[model samples]
Target chain A: MAKSVVEIKNLSKIFQRDSFSVAALESIDLDVKEGEFLCLMGPSGSGKTTLLNIIAGIDRPTGGELHVLGEDIATLSEDALATWRNVHVGFVFQTFNLIPVLTAYENVELPLLLTKLSAAERKEHVLMALKLVGLADRIDHYPRQLSGGQEQRVAIARAIVTDPTLVVADEPTGDLDAYSADEVLDILSRLNRDFKKTILMVTHDPRAAHHATVVRHLEKGQLLPVEN
Target chain B: MWRLVLKNLLRNKRRSFLTGTSVAVSLFLLSSLAMVYTALGKPLENADSIPIMMVRRATGIVFPMPASYGARIREVPGVAACASLSWFGGYWKDPANMFANLAVDPENVFKVQFASTIPPDQLEAFQRERTAAVAGRRLAEKFGWKVGDKITLLGSLWGFNPELTLRGIFSGGPDDQLWFHWEYLNEAIGRMNVVGLYWIRLEKPEMASRVGEAIDAMFRNTPNETKTESLSAFMLNFIAMLGNVRGIILLIGSAVTFAILLIVANTMAMSVRERISEAAIMRSLGFRPAHILRLFVGESLLLTLAGALLGIGGAKLLYDSLRLTQIGQFAFADLRLRPETLALCFGIALSVALLAATWPAYRAARTNIAVALRHTG
Candidate 1:
């Protein structure tokens, strides 16, 4: 069996909003092995993004141990969790949440700024990351100046610039057109197969699931059996 | 991050400029006005040993006291010297050109009040020449008067242009005054010999209050009963006549501070509101809460500090170049920005920026990343 990069046991999440209690996740027991490409599929309000967020350490699991890279992320302090997220995980969002003011190079260099990399090394890594997304020439362009496809590409470059252990993408191509979406999905598949990154993606599109090694179904706050 | 801060400030030009200009203008006014006030008080501050008490009528400083009191105060044991002066309020060439001129005892003028401030040779020249006048260097400089230059005073309160010869120019005394023989004024006023006030120096500093009381007690129930106060007390009384200046200025400063604080704070809060998503994005990018706090607050401080430097430097250049002297007959005083005022300007800038940025920075830093992301998501 492959080494498990993530292990979850009976995880549950309850959200309290103004005298209303809603369960977002219930009794989720799962494992994401090293170098595995897992895709979670569901309709709206199905907690697909919530599950990915829990694995990314940005959202807390309410009632179970969530171990990522063999460490219990639930037990970490808020700041330690931040450091852990910085060093170990990367995220690609539905909206290409690039800081509009920063250039593509600066945006891609954002995560690595927290590291002890020298300026020269940061420049090299930023250049290579943008090169990977085929945006090396557009590094000086601001977000508003970039096309939607190019902006999402820059977002992907920023996500992997620090070479994190796990990359969690939530609808990474949700805002892209067909051509752009194919380009982004192709890059994700390459990162998983060629670079051996453990990718956990949340998407409703079957075309996105085609790149995943295993696709699971999430419905009504419960993990269903594998769809494919 | 500092680069990001600079870019954020530039992203919204109008709000940033308005807040920065508000801080600039308010502090410019505050610092410049306070500097003028401080300059006005400088003479008194430096007059540590004014050396004499002024005796005035109990009614007011504008009222005249009996000239006979000069002789009586001389008889008092502690009174070492005495000189009586009547104000000679007249101008040459233009009534707008105003300076202090006093009809005083030329023989004892240098002895009682202005001793050692004038040279003995100049005092002798002033005494020997009957129409001789000793003018302060500033007044002489204003009118281009030198020794032996006969300057005519027009519209004297006694109704005569007393043609006085400038016997000497005194540099050590007040730069905006003149002293001449009382004999000329007495004769001009039909030998009335009445005076406005007497300047009396004590034999010892400790004898001031006792001698003052003794002098007033001797004149009790008399028609022109007097009030004798030390020089510092007289200066304080004059300042009190200006009517709660310090209190009013403090109130104005506080109001300006509160106003700027609110304006800048509201601006910063609005900026944070608009960037709620960006803040979450920063956190998701591994920024700790402290980072966000420092970024927002530091941006505010940078904007305010930039404005402070510009305003203070502009005020210094303007005032230093003009040395504004046209403040309603206050010809001798000038407006100047000191080093201390510069420090105060930047200090107020930094403090108010911190005050304005505190709430916004705290709220932005403590923002829930999940909720913020949902708002943006």
Candidate 2:
């Protein structure tokens, strides 16, 4: 049996604007195990992104018990949560949010700068991560210099450069073409299988869900039955 | 970190260059004017230390007094020495090419001022030779004068073109002037003892006002009544004649400094606003708020420092090449920028940079990662 890396019980999130209130997430319950590729699928406004953000430690639930890697992130302070995220969670976004000022190599080295790793060790880890994404040759290229697919590859390299315990991806392929989408999905799947990294991905595409080991659905921020 | 800042600047090279150039120009103007002000004001600061005071006609600086007033001023209590001075408005070659030309009692002018300045041998030679004159090193360099060279002064105060020999070149302690025997002018003008002003050296500097009152009391209600004041006071009179521009210097410096601050601050704010998504991504990557603050402020300071260096360097180049233009009374005659001016310029640059970075750094540091990520593309 795989060990549980993330545990959520009865999580709820409500946002208030002016005189109106909207529920972004409501009473979500789920569990993710080590090295599991769990894909969350749902309709457009089904709270998939909100749930993923909560699990990534970027946003906290209003009421719930949320734990990742044995640490209750809900109990952590903002700075502590940020530190935990640095060491434990990697993130991939739809638009490939790599700093445009930095080259592919420097962008990938961002997370490592927080650690005490020597320059040689950091360079070695970054090179290996880029190699895993099959972008070893594009290390010197900037985001504007690369294609949509190459930019996504560099972003994935940056995400995994810290060897995070979990990778949380939110609509990681929504903006890419069919071929570029497959390239990113291949990298996420490989990160799960070959590197044994736990992945919690939010996707609307059935083809992307096919690559996950276990698939789940969210309706109004509540998790449905999981299918293996 | 510096590389990151450099790369970010290069991202919008034109905008950075334009804003940086403005900072450079502001700093150049501010620093140059400050240098000039300090140079021009130093002599006034030292005026009280010198015991010598000039007793002029009570009417104003332009009015003349009798040469016999020198003897009466010397007899006054606390008066150590006195000498009569006559303005010798001489111009060489072109009438517009003016320099300091004066006629003094060669045997007595040294007893009051320029006493220890000239060599004893040169003073004796000046007293013995009526045609002999002395020039400053700067004047000599400007006109290429040797000790024995004879120069003729055309037109004016004495109403004669007096031909004189160069006797001695004195370092008037950061100043240069031409002085000759009063007898030479007397011989040309046919007036044996008429003069314009008298320089009175006090036994003690603290007795300036008291001694001044006594001298004016002796000559009061009579013709050729005198007004006595220190050298610094006279310099002030000279400055007033040229239209006191200290207020303008301060006003323009403050305006320019404020302008540069706004410009750099606006550029920084715009840059940060455009990088909202990037900052959010960094926050999501687990960079602390303090980290964000450092990056933003550090980038601004680096930008300002670059601009400041260019400005100061340009000013230095301008000063290095400046010569032959003299506008100051005494202190700022050369008008070169000093080390203190450079230090103050950099201080202002650093402080303004830090001040300009504050709001933008705070905004970037307090950015909400979730909201920013949701909104920005």
Candidate 3:
């Protein structure tokens, strides 16, 4: 009964290399509803990240009508798309791509800098996000000072600090050990169930998919039927 | 944003310090050379206001002229005062401690060379005593000479040593020269009625060239032909004897500037290359390309600004501490760094910052976010 937060129809992506063209995604039809944890599973080079990037407005599709939150994102300019992403979407990369120069507290405050928030308001939001990830004590610690699990948690805090409408993560736990991987998954699952945040994740781990409400497979850029 | 810039610079402390030191040293050398150049050309800035002229032998300044020509020069139209200045190249203690000791006509020297001011009592004492000498304030301070101090100079040219009493100390003019009675030198050198050159003061500044031409024409075709020129042109000729000093300073400054530019450009390029992945990560976080560019350029700007401060400040500190108003024959009476020079150095620093950061920042900003991320991964 939840409203559709994302809608894609007949989407295709082609990459050109010199004189040759390679299709990354073809005839992709997908819909993600609000408050749904949608997991995208695929082998290597299955256009999983490419699809995720397109949804997050980090990349443009070659052909399709793509709408997220009822806006025609494919028609937006690059600058406008970036602004929209800043306000509406959050991202978690596999490598925990937090700026090494910034502390954990400052890293979480990065996206808020783009907003019209005052200094007091930004600090409030950053502190709340770090506290949500149980990293209030390590707020002043740099990325190099933290463990792998703590770094991923800090990245998660940075992703959700702005309270975006959708959080798209590409293998958020792909580099973590089993214990750290479960910790990251538990946070992502908690963000979905408790905060009602819509999450679209790309993963190769079957165990990660087990935490998703709906899991879809993509083999050679074609989407298979959803598995409940 | 500034915090980030600071942190990034501190990330590579060694590289940043080396780059900054290079900029500091280069700018220091450049500004010092520029100050020297400015000092050399300074007299020309107010050349029109000074109505003094110099008349020497047509052949060269070293060639002596007839001291009797002083009276003829004084009779010329537009001539206010004329004095004979004979160079008594002498050293105080050691030949290495050489300075300009001149035998000047005590009666007309102050009238023609009025830039050097002395107290009324001191002026009278100087003209009354035959072997009296009036040293410049700086010269007196340098040699620790006081009134009634007896100083002996060993002449380098005439093989005569004169024991002179320091009667008074003058305050201005080229404050590094010592002047004594020309009649004393004439008596000491076997009554040779020969003079080195004549210093002529004009009724008006506009009369300089005409009076110089008139003086030269009067002595033309004689046994001792004369060449007369305005004071500024005379000083320029003195500088020209050093062989294109301005050109040499400019060349050295330009080379130093170019070398610093290349060094800073290399530092910025390396910094940007190392952070290419970080730039893409920010881009994915919805930071615009222009923002990324600003961040990179901001880092470079801070770096160069630090260098400029160190360089300009260090130059001022070192020069002020040294207080070297005179070096050899060059007199930099007011040798502080000019405001224009400071502004110029700052402008150079800003320009270097912008030029060095533009290409690297542009390349990093415009790179495709997906490709950059994937390549780094």
DockQ scores of the candidates: 0.63, 0.64, 0.64
If both were scored by TM-score, which would come out higher, candidate 1 or candidate 3?
A: 3
Question: Per-residue lDDT of B20-66 in model 3, one digit per residue for the tens?
Answer: 99999888987788778776776455667888889999888888998
- Residue clash pairs of candidate 1: none
Question: Which 10 consecutive positions of candidate 3 chain A have the poorest summed lDDT?
Answer: A219-228
Q: Across residues B1-377, which tens digit of lDDT does each residue of candidate 2 receive? A: 66776788777999989988899999998889888776656545457888899888888767777777877788899999998878888898789768878888787777777434777787778888988888777778778888888889986766888888888877664346788888888878777667777888899999999999999899999977878888877666656667767777778888888998999999899988888677778888888878777888888898898899999878988887774134443645646667888998899999889989888878877877888786553
For all predicted structures, in order, the TM-scores are 0.87, 0.86, 0.91
Q: Across residues B251-364, which tens digit of lDDT does each residue of candidate 1 receive?
A: 787787677678778888888888877888888878888888888998898888877877777788887777454321231244467677678767887898899888878887
Candidate 2 off by > 4 Å: A1-3, A221-228, B44-69, B72-80, B86-90, B114-125, B128-132, B146-168, B172-175, B181-234, B321-331, B374-377
Cα misplacement distance, residue B195 of candidate 2 (Å): 5.8
Q: How displaced is residue B216 in candidate 2, in Å?
A: 8.2
Per residue, candidate 3 scores C-alpha lDDT tens digits across A1-228 of: 999999999999999999999999999999999999999999999999999999998888999889999999989977788888888898999999988878999999999998899999999999999889889999999999999999999999999988998999999989999999999999999999999999999999999999999899998888887665
Which candidate model has the greater TM-score, 2 or 3?
A: 3
When candidate 3 is compared with the true two-chain complex, its DockQ is 0.64
Ten residues in sequence with the least summed lDDT for candidate 2 chain B: B323-332
Range of the 10 consecutive residues with the lowest summed lDDT in candidate 1 chain B: B326-335
